[model samples]
Target chain A: MKVLEDRIRQEGLILSETVLKVDSFLNHQVDTELALEIGREFGRLFAGQGITKVLTIEASGIQFAMAAGIALKVPFVYAKKKKAVTQAEQMYTAPVTSFTRGETYQVSISRHYLGPDDKVLIVDDFLATGAALVGLVTIVREAGAQLAGVGCVIEKGFQEGRGLLEEMGVRVHSLARISSMAPGEVQFVDHNDPIRIKEKV
Target chain B: MKVLEDRIRQEGLILSETVLKVDSFLNHQVDTELALEIGREFGRLFAGQGITKVLTIEASGIQFAMAAGIALKVPFVYAKKKKAVTQAEQMYTAPVTSFTRGETYQVSISRHYLGPDDKVLIVDDFLATGAALVGLVTIVREAGAQLAGVGCVIEKGFQEGRGLLEEMGVRVHSLARISSMAPGEVQFVDHNDPIRIKEKV
Candidate 1:
């Protein structure tokens, strides 16, 4: 978590008062050394509860989920944005709105991959409005699977994304929690809720 | 490579003669354990290239690239299919046609990430018509970066992908080469050229 927080300070670019671009180190251009460490940290936090699989939406979340999957010795599933050519008919679907892309799309998982017997840990790069997490939670419920928890590299705490997931009784763990992203400065803002922050991890 | 071939044999499904799906364990549903091994194998193939970075088109490629990036201890960059709000103005671009999506789209990389001094290894989950790889190569060339090589988990030998990459003078290594996906079978194609298949870890 410290590695991620330090990297955010060093390579994460503040694009505006509301958005931070981690392209130099996180999403676009990935720092694998840091990803490995972050993956290990997730492994530490969710050592139990029988994580049968790691679920994530495509693109940015793919790498992080794979990292955690390796650390936790669990397989991962990527919810594709596009309909794959060989896709099956049976799948669980949910709608999601992206704060960054400014689009609402359907995210789905094949029924063949996820089932009622599975417990899933959801992972992603950033948690801003919490819509993506909500989408994943919806898909998990559709499959009759148990939600192990949610893990993120960075959480925009000022956005109150945590409250949305907490309302669903889902534990959210974020390596770096941003209190505010104003101009050139970023804040950690997680010590106020020690128990919740631990749940975030 | 044998492991990948075995995985395909075990879980890969063939839909029609042209479309094959390994969504059960490759891209859609990822086996991180196998992903790690494939990453190490790739590191062995491109070991002395002095690769400063690994590059790929986003969605499916991100996880594989991240694993290889970790194995090689380098940073990895993934081009975006959809533009993010935090994306920069200066960028390198190329057009890629997606078979599944049945459309042509541009893949973009931030100018801040690519440069003349960088050694890049382009990676992806599958190589079909080579459109994505070629588009990725264009972005790399536009930035004047050294393309160390290209790596893929699967290559459809019946398709024109490898020939196109070879014509471009870029070395390509595919873990499993599918000669034919005849009706219900996905057969692993053998390479007659030792130069293309033989390498050390």
Candidate 2:
């Protein structure tokens, strides 16, 4: 997490108080080694949970989910942003509003892939606003699958995302939690502080 | 590669002559171990190419690209389907028409991640009409980067993707090359046949 925070400080482009772009390494372009390390961290965090699957939304979250899946040695399922022509079967669906894109899109996963017999760990790149993560949680519950927890690569700690998931009784873990940020400056939630501990159960 | 071919034979649903769904293991619900193996196979194929980077389009291609990146010990960058708010810089752009989605979308990569000094290997889940791959190839070329080749997990051999890439003088390697498929039957381009060899460079 220190490494990630350091990388954020070094390479992250803070456009405003709310928009932080780690595109140089995290999402748009990726550091594969760093991604795998993030996965290992997630794996260490949730090692004993008997996770049957790793779940995430498409595009941005795929890499982290894939990495977590590799670490956990489980299959990872990404909910599609939209239903494709090939995905005509029964699906568990939810709508996610993207504040960045300023649009709401339906996220779906085939009923065939997720169901009651599985335990799921949800992963993603960023947790802000909680829009997409909330949608994924709904789908996981709808599929009758057991929720392991949410593992995020980065979390906007100042936002309502962590509050929303905790209210839903989801144990959340974020490798790097940003407490605040502005152009030319950024701050992370102190990991040593007991008051700011991430996992809720 | 034989294991991949077997997985397709066993779990692949032949939805039509053109659509073979391997969502059970490849794209939607990814088999992590198998994906790593596929990465190793790609590493073996493109080994010694001095691949500084691995590239792919977002959504489905991220997993394979990540795997290939791991195998090659290089960073990987995925082209965004559209220019996001954070992506305000100059980008290498190309438009691609998706036959399945029946729409055309512009794919772009930031000008920062790729350049003349980088050697790139493009990886993807499927090689069908070559629309996306062609767009990626164009972006790589436009970035003035050296493209080692393209590696596909599965290729619709009956389609024009390979021909298109070959026409561009790019090397193509697909783990499984399907000659034909319909309903319950599928056939692969025989690997033993020298005439069906994939690399053209």
Candidate 3:
């Protein structure tokens, strides 16, 4: 997580107190090696969970989910933001509001993919408003699958996302947790702090 | 590639003459081990090309791009279908019409990630009408980057995608090329055929 925090410090563009863009490496453009390392970290975190699947939303979360799936040696399923023409089967659906895009969209996964037999690990790039993650959690529960907790590449620790998930009794782990950030300076929660570690589970 | 072809034969649903759904493995619910094998296959195909980066459009293409980037040991960038608030910089944009979605959208990549010095390999999940691939090719050209070629997981051989890319003097390699398909039946163009081999490069 230090390497990710360092990269964030070095390359992350902080547009405002609430807007931090790691497009140079994380989302828009990606560092494949770093992504794999993040996956390994997630793999290590949830190694004994017997994860049958990795779940995420489309676009941004696909890479991290794919990486985690690779690390866990399981298939990853991404909920589509919009239902495509081909996806005409029964689906588990939940509405999510994007903090960055400022729009609410329905996220869905085919009923054929998820069932009671599956155990899912949800992964994503950023956990900010927690809206999307909340939506995914709903879908996982709706599918009757066991939740293996959430793994995030980056978490906005100041936001209500972690609080919401914890309230839902979903254990969460973020590789890089940003406590605060401004245009020129950014602060991170000490990843090794006993308090934060106790709160994570 | 044989394994990919076999997966398609076994799991692929032939929805129509034009639509072959491999979402059970390729896109929606991705088989991580198979995806890694795909990456390795792409790596073997474009091994000596000095590919500095792998590129693709967002959503479906992200997984394949990530895999290819992993195989090539390079970074990958995905063109955003919609420009986000954080992406306020100059971008290389191109319009693309989706064959499946029956819509047109502009795909954009930031100016910072691509340049003349970079060699890029564009990867995507499907090569159908070549609309999206053409858009990506235009963006890569606009960035003044050297394009190594395009690698597709599956190609609708009956479609114009390959012809369109070939017309642009671009090399393309698809792991599985489907000649035709209909409900309950699918046929693939023999990969080892000398005529197809000569045309690929």
Candidate 4:
């Protein structure tokens, strides 16, 4: 986590006093080394929690999810943004509102992928308003699967997302938590590395 | 590549003689061990080449790209499918036709991520019609970057992808080449233990 915070300070750009433009290393232009380290951290946190599947919403989330999958020796599945006709008719569907895109869209995963037996660990790149995570949780509940916990590489702790997930009683584990962002400084939430936390945030 | 051919034989589902569903292991839900092997195989193929960057498209392509990136000890940049205002305006962009979704969309990567000094190896999950590859190549060219070659896990030899790349004067390396697929039967282009090109029926 110190490595991430350091990397963020060195490479990440602050856009509009709030948005962290990690396009060089995190989301757009990926750093496999950093991702692998982040994946190992996630594995350390949730590897022993009977995680049958690691779920994430697609585009930015796939690489980190795959890294975690590799480290934990478990498979990861991402929800497709669009539903191609070739996909199965039976799916667990949910609506997600993107704070960046400023629109609501339906994302779904095939029913064949998730089952009642799965204890799912949801992971993502960023959590702002918790809309995407909420959508993912809806899909997991629809599948009758157990929500093991939610994990994120970065979390904007000043946002309402943390409280929302906590309200659902889902344990949330974020590697980097940005507690405050004023003009010049960014603060992070205090944490003791969690083996497992039942409460979300 | 025998292991890959065997995996296709055992776990692949033939749909309508044209679509072979390996999503259980290759896409959707990824098998990390198999993916790792595939990545190493790619590393062996391009070992002598100076591959500075591994470039791929987002979602399904990210997993394989990351695997190759890790094996090759290089960073990878995945071209995002969606548009965001935060991205660099001077980025190279190209349009691609998708066989799965039956649509055409544009993909782009920031000009900063790739440049004249970079030697890139483009990677993807599947190469069917070579449309996606075309888009990636266009972007790479626009950035004045040197493309070492293209690497794919599975190539549908029956399809026109290889011919298209060959016509464009690009070398392609595929682990497993499928000659034909008819519901129950899937034929592979054979190879020796060293992955030499053997006879193909």
Candidate-wise lDDT, in order: 0.83, 0.89, 0.89, 0.83
RMSD of 2: 5.7
Model 3 bad stretches (over 4 Å):
A191-201, B191-201
**Residue range A7-84, candidate 3, lDDT tens digits:** 887787777778888988999999999999999999999999899999999989999999999899999999999988
Per-residue lDDT of candidate 1, residues B76-142 (tens digit): 9999985667775777888889876678988999898899999999999999899999999988999
Candidate 2's C-alpha runs over 4 A off are: A191-201, B191-201
In candidate 3 the C-alpha lDDT for residue A53 amounts to: 97
The candidates, ranked best first by lDDT, are: 3, 2, 1, 4
All predictions: root-mean-square deviation over Cα?
5.8, 5.7, 5.6, 6.1
lDDT of 3 by residue, B1-201 (tens): 899988887778776678878888999999999999999999999999799999999899999999999999999999999888888889899999999899999999999999999999999999999999999999899889999999999999999999999999999999999887656667778744322111000
Query: DockQ order of candidates, best first?
Result: 3, 2, 1, 4
lDDT (Cα, tens digit) per residue for candidate 4, span A83-184: 874565577889898887788888989888899999998999998899999899889998999998898998888788989999989899888888765544
Residue B43 accuracy (lDDT) in model 1? 94
Error of 1 at B52 (Å): 0.9
Range of the 10 consecutive residues with the lowest summed lDDT in candidate 3 chain A: A192-201
- Residues A1-201 of candidate 2 have per-residue lDDT tens digits of 888988887788777778888988999889999999999999999999899999999989998998999999999999999977778788899999996788899999999899999999999999999999999999999999999999999899999999999999999999999888766777788744322211111
